[model samples]
Target: MSVIGKMLTLLRGSARELGESVVDANATRIYEQEIIDARNAILKAKSELTGVMAKEMQSAREIERIRAEALRLEDLALEALGKGKEALAEEVAVKIAETEQQLEEQSRVHADYALQVGKLKDLIKSAEAKVREHEREVAIARTTESVYKATRSISDNIGASGSKLLNARESLDRIKRRHEELADRMAAAESLDKETGTRALEIKLAEAGIGGDAERARRVMERIRARKTDAEGQ
Candidate 1:
C-alpha cells in the first residue's frame, strides 16, 4: 500500500469516532430533558392538590357555621312559643324550619365536597405512583445507556488500534518490496563477476589435467546457442 492510502484510512477512522461521539451526546441530552419534564409534572400535581385541600377546608368551615346558626334559631323558636305569643312564635318556627332546610342542603354540599376532596387526594396518590414509575424508567434507561457507552468505547478503541496496525503493515510491505528490488539489482550486478570466477576455476582445473578448458567452453557455448535457438523458435 502507498502512504496516501494509509493516511486516508486514518482519516476515515477519526471521522467515525467523531460521529459516534455526537450520537452519544445527543442521546444523553434527550434523557436529561425527559427527566426534567417528569419532575415538573410531579410538582404541578402536588401544587394542585394543595389548592384543592385548602378550598375543601373552607367549605367545611362554612357548613359548620350554617349548622350552628340553624340550632340557635330553633332554640329561639321554642322560647317564643313558651311565652304565649302565638303569631310571633309561629313566625320564628317558620324561620327555624327554613334555616334547618338550608343547613341540610349545606350538609349535603359539604359531604359532596369532602368526597371530591378524597378523590383529589387519590388522584395525587396516583400521580405520585406515576412519578415513581417514571423515575424507575429513567434509571433503567440510564443503565442501558451506560452499557451502550461502554461497548462503544471498547469498539472505538479497537477500531483505532486496528487502523494503526493496518497502517504499520502497509508500511512494512512497502519497505519489504523496496528491499527485494534492491536485492534483485545487486544480484544482477554480480552475475558477470560470478561467471568470470567460474571460468578462471575451470582453466586451473584443466591445466591440472582434470579436463580441457576447450572442451568445457565448447559445451557451454553449445548449451547457450541451444537456448537462443529455442527462444527464437518460440
Candidate 2:
C-alpha cells in the first residue's frame, strides 16, 4: 500500500474505535439512569407503605377506643335498664353496632392498600431486571457494530489500494509502449541511414564516370545464362 493509503487505513480504524467508545459511553449512561430510576421508585413505594402502615395503626387505635367507649356506654345502659330505663339501653346497643361495622370497613381498606404496595414492589423489581437485560443487549449490539464498521473500513481501504496498484501498472505499461515506439523509430532511422549511404555511394560512382568493364559484364552475363539453362534442364 501507498503511504497515503496506510494513513487512511489507520484513520478509519481510529474512527471505528471512537464510534464504539461513544456507543459504549451512551449505553453506560442509559443503564445507570435506568438503575437509578428503578431504585428511586422502590424507595418511594417503601416510603408510601410506611405512611400507610402508620395510618392503619392509628385507625386500629381509634377502633379500639370506640370499642372501649361502647362497652362503657353498654354498662351504663344495663345499669339504667335494671332501674327500668329500657329505651336508653336500646340506643346504646345501636351505637355499638354502627361503630363495629365502621371498624371492619377500615380494616379491609388497610389490607387493600398493603396488597397494592406489594404489587408495586414486584413491578419495580421486574423493571430493574428488564433494564439490566436491555443493557446487555446494547453491549452486544455495540460490539457487533464496531466489528462490522472496522471490517468494512478495512475492506474499502484494501480495494482502494488495489485500484491504485492497477493504475500504477497501467502507467508503467504506457511508459513501456512509449519506449517501444521510440525504439522502432530509431530502427527505422538506422535503416534509412543505410539506404542513404548506399544511394550516396551509387551517385559518387556515377559522378566519377566509373562504368562496369566489358570483360567483367560479359562474365556476369555468362553466369546468368548458365543458371537459366540449369533451371530449364531441371
Candidate 3:
C-alpha cells in the first residue's frame, strides 16, 4: 500500500480499538443505569396503583352508604303500614320500590368494582413479588458490574501501556536507523580521507622520483633473492 493508505488503515484500526475499549469500560455504568430505570418503573407502577386503590376505597364506601339507605327506606315503609296510614304506606311503598331498584343497580356496579378490586390486589401482589425477585437480580447485576468494571479497568490500563510501549519501540527503532545512517556517513568520510591521503602521498613520491622505477628495481632484487634461495634448498 501507499504510505498514506497504510497510515489511514492504522488510524481506522486504532479508532475501532479505542471505541471498543470505551464501550467495554462503560458497560458497567450502562447496566447500573438500566437497573435504576427498572426500579423507577416499579415506583411508577406503585404510584399509579395507589391512585387506583384510593378510587376503589371511595367506591367501596359509597356502595356501603347506598346499601344502608336502601335498608332505611324498607324500614320506613314497614313502619308506615303498621301505623294504619294507607296513603302514607302507599307512598312509602313506591319510594321503597325506587330505592330497591337503585340498590339493585348499585349492587351490580359494586359487584363489578369488588371483583376489580380483588383482581387489582392480586395484580399488585404479583407485581410486588416480581419486583422483590428482581431486586435479587439487581444485586447480582451490581456485583457483576463491579467485576466487569475491574476487569475492564485492568484491560484498559494494559492496552494503554501497550500502546505507549509500541510508540517507544518505534521511536527507538527510528533513532537506531538514524544512528546507523550517521555511522555509514562517517565510515564513508573516513574511507575518502584515506584514499585522498594515499593519492597525495603517491604524488609526493613521484615528485621525489620514487613512484615507478625504484619500486620496479626493488621487485627485481626480490626475485633474484628468491631464485638463489630456491637453488640452495635444492
Candidates' lDDT values, in order?
Answer: 0.69, 0.70, 0.67
Using alpha carbons, what is the TM-score of model 2? 0.41
Worst 10 residues of 1 by lDDT: 18-27
What would the per-residue lDDT of candidate 2 be over residues 1-234, giving only the tens digit for each residue?
Answer: 443453345446755555534344565577668767866776786787677667767766776777788688778878978989888878877886886777688678767766766776677678667667656655655665577678768768988788533577889999999999999999998888766877666666666655545556768899999999999999
Q: Tens digit of lDDT per residue, candidate 3, span 180-221?
A: 999999999888876687876787787676867777887899
Q: Over 4 Å off in model 2, which ranges?
A: 1-28, 123-234
Candidates 1 and 3, the one with greater lDDT: 1
Score residue 37 of candidate 3 by CA lDDT: 65
Q: TM-scores, in order shown?
A: 0.50, 0.41, 0.41
lDDT of 1 by residue, 1-234 (tens): 443453345346754454333233454466567657756766776787687677778877877887788788777777887888788878977887887788788778777767777876676677666556545544554554465578788778988787533577889999999999999999976886656777767767777757786678878999999999999999
> TM-score order of candidates, best first?
1, 2, 3
What are the candidates' C-alpha RMSDs? 22.1, 22.5, 23.7
lDDT, candidate 3, equals 0.67
